[model samples]
Target: MVFDGLTETAVAGRPAWRHDASGVLFRRVPGGTYQMGLSDAEMAALSAHADASVMLDDAHRMRPIRTVTVEPFLMARHPLTVAQVRHWLPDYEDDYVDDDDAAAHLEDEWLDALLEALPFRLPSEAEWEYAARAGTTTLTWRGDEAPTEEQLLDRFGVEAEVAATENPFGLAAMGSLTERCADRYGIGYAEPAPADGPPVVRGGAADASPWQGCGEWLLALPASRGWQDMFTSIRPVI
Candidate 1:
């Protein structure tokens, strides 16, 4: 489905700057309010799932779904690719390596060009979920039941392919990746962001069993910083 919400100012041109990576595309999501996390009712239902697929303790941190109001921003159309990320920080890789190295080796020209091209930055979990939902209030983007890992693989595959058909909002890979964002880990609507912590990641990750294809998120422990393995990736927004 085509999304009507987006801004007029996405990064437009400059083909020579990009190499190996497909040029990033962003969707302008109109500002509005939406439920940011699991609701009390939804949590209760998960507690009662017959197979214990949704653990209560594991989900407790995401409780108290709050109505989040976001400002208009252009969200990346796909999970940030390795090539795309490498373009900015040459030494970066989507791995659990030292996060200090995540951006240690950077090309000044690429950085300047990126800033000039657009206001590129990672999306917060709130913004990420808002764009991912696009307007739906269901378990999966297009389903009534929770999705499975196999489902995620069958649909998106490894590397999180750029979606051919987008969600209702025209956003891609929302369910296929446990998208890493800019917020400090352990942050929630009920509390303030910590001074230092592993960044929170949104959307389910491919190969992450049940979590993939479903709306479960992960909080990167400090031990796992700079880790953007198959399950971790950034979705830039302005």
Candidate 2:
């Protein structure tokens, strides 16, 4: 999408900015409240599939569907590409494009240092879901049609390609990478998260060729959740 000044400031509270040094563009997301979990119909559809029950059993954790409010904040227009990370770590090496492709294999210490040096912070899980949905209440940001068992299972994997198109917010790759977030992993929305829990990860990285699991593919849905991966990427917030 075009990064014109008019588009950047069109929204009342939302605004956009560009980090010249790293060439990372930030888009302002207009904040509002949204239902943060699976709808009744979605639950019913998944439960009806006997074979997928084992793979999707934990899907209940997204339940007790709650209305969550998110305040307006800036989010990276694209995942932090390897090229941008190289601005801070010049010697970094990767096959992905410097400006266009998402960065991966980031360690926690590196993220901490990057946050310390930059004006950005990691987004919360709620904020990530809100941005991914971009105002749509659907099974996937792509649509509301409940996916057939075969469709959901075969749609994403090592063989699948992450679409380059943007969501309504003009953000790209919302379903591409398993992005690390700031929230602790929890059992369910109604249950409290253990203090020692692993960090939450969202926006399933279906392109990760090394991950051969069936469950992670379901995370491609906007409402689906998962834990951080050894090769998770970052989509910073400001």
Candidate 3:
């Protein structure tokens, strides 16, 4: 879980930064305008079922279609692990019953580190989708040749399971792992807080429930403040 020194690069003539932390290399993603949101097929899938429980509706967690614009920024290449977050805020407190609880407690420190390390903030629902898509127009980032349940299961090294095609960026688990997805307007995830709080994690995890990774959109519940976990522990984009 050791992090190497920061590596520097230039984007659009501006100095960009990247870091290798916890065996993942986070590279700065120069932001630009891109369409976001679910595809017709996805919408149809949600609408095909009239039962509110299985339908895709805003009240039921579906993001309404919309247009959005975003500024350039950086993001982590992968989900932040417990070991990674512990690097900076060794004393991160966990109030929940399990690792999920620990994730919630360390949120504040995570934000703090992110702010200190770069001139950016967490990707908005719109931003998250734009990046996850990595410039593609498909149900999931992977494309129409969606992975079969078997393929996805194989990737996870588990029993047979369904798989959503990844977008062009090689970002697996966007639809399967995380609910955050691009709509006609932009990217969005389930808001972590009911009133006000930091953003929640976007991608799904291996430890989540089977329903968590259903072909439907995936998103994590928000737990703590961004600064609580010393963002250093979370992944960072160059």
lDDT of each: 0.51, 0.66, 0.39
Candidate 2 on 51-129: residue-level lDDT in tens?
Answer: 4464366667777788999998878876776667767766665543333344444666766566566557899988998
What lDDT score goes with residue 78 in model 2? Answer: 63
Error of 3 at 83 (Å): 2.4
In angstroms, the error of model 1 at 96 is 9.4
What tens-digit string does per-residue lDDT give for candidate 1 at 37-128?
76554555455445435344555466567778999876665655555655565655434323431211122354344435534677777787
TM-score of every model versus the real structure: 0.63, 0.76, 0.51
lDDT of 3 by residue, 18-98 (tens): 454433334345567764445455555445434323324432243434465776655544444344445544654543224
For residue 104, give model 1's deviation from the true position in Å: 17
Off by over 4 Å in 1: 1-22, 44-49, 89-119, 150-161, 207-231
Best by lDDT: 2
| Candidate 3 ranges beyond 4 A from true positions | 1-5, 8-17, 20-24, 39-41, 45-55, 58-63, 92-120, 144-167, 170-201, 205-207, 211-238
Error of 3 at 59 (Å): 7.3
- Order of candidates by lDDT, top first? 2, 1, 3
TM-score of 2: 0.76
Top-down TM-score ranking: 2, 1, 3
lDDT of 2: 0.66
